[model samples]
Target: MTDGEGWFVVNACESRWRDDGTLGSYCTFEGKRRFPHFGININVLGPGEALGMYHRENAQEAFLVLAGECTLIVEGKRRPLATWDFFYCAPGTEHVIVATSEQNAIVLAVGARGRGVGGGVVYRVSKEAARHGASVERETTSSAEAYAEAHADLPRSRWVPYREGWLPSDR
Candidate 1:
């Protein structure tokens, strides 16, 4: 629902679960609009699933481990993060999050959108990110190349029709 020209709200559970291949399932309470200037989403990651390619961007990004455990791989370092843990990625700082617990992990991600040209983002080939299939084999700015194995490209990944029980209960 919307109120005024610039405000809206939707329950996280009511939003559709967008599956971005190896990135697993997620949702950004937006429907069919030009990608929001400020992006936000809740990622539902199964064990071994990752948030996305290990890459840095010209824009800053932040994440919160809302539930479950995940390994945060940043610039080749692996750090464990659990519920309530928050992480910040400064401009040009490479990072990726991978669920490491036996169950699942829920991460709330927010980032400032960058313009579409001149290195808004760059994918990196990191052994640490590869642990969960979140790294590219070659350093490039192409999302398609970085996620070729999983058939994902940000331009084409977003909201979809909702599915029942998209979020599994904690085990």
Candidate 2:
């Protein structure tokens, strides 16, 4: 929804969600709206679920654990994160977040967009990330190879309704 002005606002509950049954879901805030320079998303993960594969990008990235708990596997190391814990990854820092709490977790992810000017991604293998089903068998730079058949039996991500419980009011 938009006001009479040039800028607009959207509540998460009123946004669209991209859901992948096994890995969990997210509201990318980019359905009809395209964000230049950077991309952001609100990821929702249930216990034992992860947001994506283990990888490092030349573009900087960060994540805020908004609620519940998570385990951050970065460069083969493991660190537990709680609500309000902020994680920053400089360019080329391989990482992935996994839900470690009993309840569903909410993570706010923000990352620089575009692979131009030394921008690229490298999928890395991590024993820590692999336990969570987030690592590739071998180190590879191709996202397609790393994610293809990642969860063949599970449904791929598709737009769904903005799940209400993720909002603070519903918590």
Candidate 3:
């Protein structure tokens, strides 16, 4: 579909979205102009190239694999994703995505852009935990814990315990 107004076809060879070795294109309708609800991007992850696990403060993301194979590491569980596979990373969920095969895999990623307010918020743990490389851990009750403590009255508390279903490795 080609329209002279309010529509644009972004060439895949040139895209503004950061690429972690992923070949793809995006059609930004209202882009940043839409603020919280932006357009969408199609990503083609090359072999051995996987997106690192990270979380946004407020964006809720979802991905659909159009071709090839890949792995989705949401929260902490790794799930194989082939063509026609869809994955969702709701707001506050710490997650990562990786390409599993030698061939490139195409994936469509969409999400809302906004400030995050929830549990999965990353926080600095104890010196021991930090020293031992405990990395991101469940909040127990510490001065630092107060920093990344999931926001008060989060609507998804009941699901926090089962966050492992998404992440590659649940802490």
Q: Give the root-mean-square deviation of each candidate in angstroms.
A: 3.5, 2.7, 13.3
The global C-alpha lDDT for each of the candidates, from Candidate 1 onward, is 0.80, 0.84, 0.49
Question: Per-residue alpha-carbon lDDT of model 2 for 1-171, expressed as tens digits?
Answer: 332435667877777788877778888766565676788888989999887899999899989999999999998999999999999999989899999999999999999898675449888889989899999999887766788757677766688887677666752
Q: Rank the candidates by lDDT, best first.
A: 2, 1, 3
Q: Can you give the TM-score per candidate against the true fold?
A: 0.85, 0.90, 0.53
Best by TM-score: 2
C-alpha RMSD (angstroms) for model 3 = 13.3
For 1-171, candidate 1 gives per-residue lDDT tens digits of 232367666777776568765577888776666355778888888889898889989998899998889999998999999999999889989899999998779899999876468648899889988767888888988876777776633456655665555555421
Give the clashing residue pairs of candidate 1, or none.
Answer: none
Worst 10 residues of 2 by lDDT: 1-10
**Candidate 1 overall lDDT versus native:** 0.80
